[model samples]
Target: MLDADLKEQLKAYLERVTRPIEITASVDDSAASNELRGLLADLTALSDKITVTERRDDDQRKPSFALTTPGQDISLRFAGIPLGHEFTSLVLALLQVGGHPSKLAADVIEQIRNLDGDFKFETYFSLSCHNCPDVVQALNLMAVLNPRIQHVAIDGALFQSEVDERQVGSVPMIFLNGQMFGAGRMSAEEILAKVDTGASAREAEKLKAKAAFDVLIVGGGPAGAAAAIYAARKGIRTGIAAERFGGQVLDTMGIENFISVKETEGPKMAAALEQHVRQYDVDLMNLQRAEKLVAAGDDGLVEVQLAGGASLKSKTVILSTGARWRQMGVPGENEYRNKGVAYCPHCDGPLFKGKRVAVIGGGNSGVEAAIDLAGIVTHVTLIEFDSKLRADAVLQRKLYSLPNVRVILSALSTEVTGDGQKVNGLTYKDRGTDEQHHVELEGIFVQIGLLPNTEWLKDSGVALSPRGEIIVDDRGQTSLPGVFAAGDVTTVPYKQIVIAMGEGSKAALSAFDHLIRHSAPAESAKAA
Candidate 1:
């Protein structure tokens, strides 16, 4: 069931529907059918425009779902209950089918309308994959607009046999026309580009040529965007290369602690960030991975070499390369990353509701995660390798306040044990006594720490913390004179959205100051 605010939002979004949408389910005596029934009932009760009806079709072979107006057959179908992040997918799909405006670009909708052939998109996704929702929403919107396209978002956990047959290790693995098309989080534009054959192709192509610049930013996240915007405003040639713009923000879910904003989802914030950056002529080259970082030598020009051999050179560089999740380096950890084990509790916790789970690490992140999960999940076991929890006393108190949470200290997470299908439990060791024990649970959240994306600059003489985070001063200046760093990749004490944005602005301003102090007046001035 949706929260009050979310329910209100859904109501407002669905109120414009000029047509009635009936959610039909092929029911049986099974709990799965009942779950489908209950979820649909809650959804239909939201508005008079929506209705639910079920037929006792015990002989049906496939999963059940149908969403169309009464006395109409152009209904959308979902094979399973859209739980976890997929809940968003369900609501968005309803809106789209009920005549809500398409979230895709106008040109994209035109392209979708012109598509030929009966193309089916079978997207294998786990409810926990934060990247899955964007793709699902886009695909569902396209399906709503185009009659030729059929998008089915299947839960990888629910259909483990199909997932194993395809050897799917991660999601959302998208298959088009019954063949694997692509995987992971791709923009709606990119998805259409993959299925198109016209002008859109030329427009959506990844950077074909790299242009020289005065300041080359290595990332397209908040830090890089801030740096580029600041440099561009100074009339300096600025360029940015991002593997994917928005960095970790794309993999995040609900963000309530972003300062002024009351609430916003990750994808919405990411889109807005990109829109703001694009307002300036910051030569944004997305989908470009930075493979090497070269410090300026006698030439006094730094070069950021991308993966495809296109290099962008500039007078200054701001390393905003973000950090990634610190994986539990044990067997089956990688195997079942999205299958049952997850890192972002905010994105995945709802999937394990009424199910037992374990949190590895007793730091603020782990303890906070355990406390949050306690409300949704049946039980949460918090594990820490040290004698005491590293979290603040305040957070520890809040964590201890939860009755469903139990803390275990001096414990080392040994292995994430699971079936070939999905995670079933986890094995940890008593660090003090060297005794190993395994606890049965449906999920494991590894919240040890973040590993910075500064490995490319390791040999470039950038000062890094012992844990590999780029060390920066108060002014965002790195050890190297012309280089600055910000965001989670830097030595910032708290890795947060507002802090990252502020650090990015500081880094950009610092870079600009360096240019004015060291470079020629002609190059420093706007006219130059």
Candidate 2:
């Protein structure tokens, strides 16, 4: 049975819910002196407990504090933008202030509690980024351990002005005293080392070894992901840098013939593949752009600078930026992308069920889309610029097997016909005989050959084939020293999810080997 006093207190607390209170100047007040007067009045109210202030010191005023109760002031110089990891940190901070102490290791807590000087840390990130969540929690733990350190997060998208002011471009950006730390996901120890300088400069530099791993995998696509997994599982500290978590796999619409999984979507498969690699201690970064690569110290470590100028050093680097669907570059393609024009049949296939659609291109993707669409749609017209379909014989056989599918050989898309709101049909011309025709379609699936996402590596010393694939060895080693390449960006043929995953595992293992070799001297030196 609850005590009478406790029961009454609980009831009172439940009944006292109110808006987060604040005292501010009236909208009509324009003079600076009037605003100052408003501030004085609010402070008086705060002292008397007449009102609770959410924001400390009204906008554009110096901070003035009142600790009526311990940790009760929920104040900020800037309104809580609360985006990305910072949002989670804000919640944690509120929870701590609201009375639930965070559960960090006692040692980590002790280290933070002893800090004496002011430490202001700002993290920049995007909410949509997957890896930002982990790094955000790490920072929150540090904040919980030390009350002297003021932590803040700025949303890269919503707070574009702040981001531009700080020159932030990517998610999971860490800025300590206006100096850029690393980007994407980072460890707590690295951050702590930078702030708490207890070691000698030479020792600190060695301890702050940016890239510990020998091989750095640049993509989380099939090839790169597989490489990282294999290398890290074999006791290598392989690091993978990727713009998005799943890489090209995330864009794939569907996977029907990838060995074990008979039917699956791109994102789902990528997720499963990612989960497989998560068990290892690989430093995987999703939604991070690899900006520049230059050789680091004599240990063969290559420092990779990210979009926000966060540098990481690794001995081996793998370039596995896969290919994307070739765009039509025509007018209506961009305007009605999600409206009616799509790239993946698996992702957008169900939406067009029983509707008429056109499959553009004569390659394997085009043939496969035509075959797949024929079963789901009322009719499927397979359009090809060349006189003959370029797909394999088995896929061509399947295309011919579908009664509702028609093969338009030697035809090119002149223009996509849409009703301004959505796609309606397409106008095409024959390449061989120069004939023009129009066909109504509810959806148009583009299945042309893929284009490599190597625009950034144009001058990065990594050799790209004439077809734009990164030239890599069987073990995912690239042309450049201390750099490896894998997956769709490489010369590997047959762009399939399983193959990419396999390649990723292999690349990871190779990178691990490189890491082991590089760490040997350091471990021996420590022993000595």
The CA lDDT of each predicted structure is 0.79, 0.64
Ten-residue region with minimum lDDT total, candidate 1 = 199-208
lDDT of 2: 0.64
Give the Å shift of residue 489 in candidate 2. 0.7
Among all candidates shown, the one with the greatest lDDT:
1
TM-score computed on alpha carbons, candidate 1: 0.77
Worst 10 residues of 2 by lDDT: 60-69
**Model 2: how large is the Cα RMSD against the reference?**
13.9
Runs off by more than 4 Å, candidate 1 = 1-76, 79-103, 106-119, 123-132, 145-148, 154-186, 189-210, 254-256, 262-265, 297-301, 350-355, 375-378, 401-404, 460-463, 479-481, 521-528
Candidate 1: residue pairs that collide: none
TM-score of each: 0.77, 0.55
